[model samples]
Target: MDNYARLKQVWIAVIYLLLLAIIIPWYWPEEDVRQFYGFPIWALLSLSGLFLTSCFTAWVCLGREVTKE
Candidate 1:
């Protein structure tokens, strides 16, 4: 792999780490009870993060070039 490819992978990994952090509800307050669209706010936020991660992964996978070695 080249330097550019390594850098790209590092950036992708950072994004994924951010998504993972968002998906985890460790930051939400335990006693707070907020709701949105009938679901808990934290739950919705986690779900949204998950959806975004999925979309990002799909975009990356589908948009990547195919190389024959």
Candidate 2:
């Protein structure tokens, strides 16, 4: 409920928004066909983005301090 906490939350939200943007393949060309390890290139990128988002969320959750009010 303090300024620092609010700022931190805003930064976290911005990062999450960026990650969400990366997870979507809107930038990939529709006609392009490429595969890596049996998976499409876009699919691979999206999956990796999801993985990074998950890791970031876990790190934020696990590293936060709990305060008793």
Candidate 3:
């Protein structure tokens, strides 16, 4: 696979794992959920990364199978 293809695969895998983490609860000490810039830590990071990866995958797929005139 070419560089773009490899990178795309890595990103797709990472996003899938992140989604799994988000959905499945894990062990965490009871504490107030901290907010950074008014965003929850887990929500901010996981969701943002998930969105970024999705957009990137879409862009790559668009280039792979279609052309714009």
Off by over 4 Å in 2: none
**Top TM-score hit:** 1
State the weakest 10-residue window (summed lDDT) of model 2. 31-40
TM, every model: 0.91, 0.87, 0.45
Query: Residue 21, candidate 3: how far off, in angstroms?
Result: 5.5
Per-residue CA lDDT of model 1 for 1-69, tens digit only, reads 999999999999999999999999999999979998889999999999999999999999999999899
Clashing residue pairs in candidate 2 are none
Candidate with the larger TM-score of 2 and 3: 2
- Candidate lDDT scores, in order, read 0.96, 0.95, 0.69
lDDT of 3 by residue, 1-69 (tens): 899979978987887677667644364335758889997676666677677667766876676765589
What's the lDDT of the predicted structure labeled candidate 3?
0.69
> Clashes in model 1: which pairs?
none
Count of backbone clashes for each model?
A: 0, 0, 0
Model with the higher TM-score, candidate 1 or 2: 1
Global Cα lDDT for candidate 2: 0.95
Q: How many Å off is the CA of 5 in candidate 2?
A: 0.7
TM-score (C-alpha, index-matched) for candidate 3? 0.45
Candidate 3 collision pairs: none
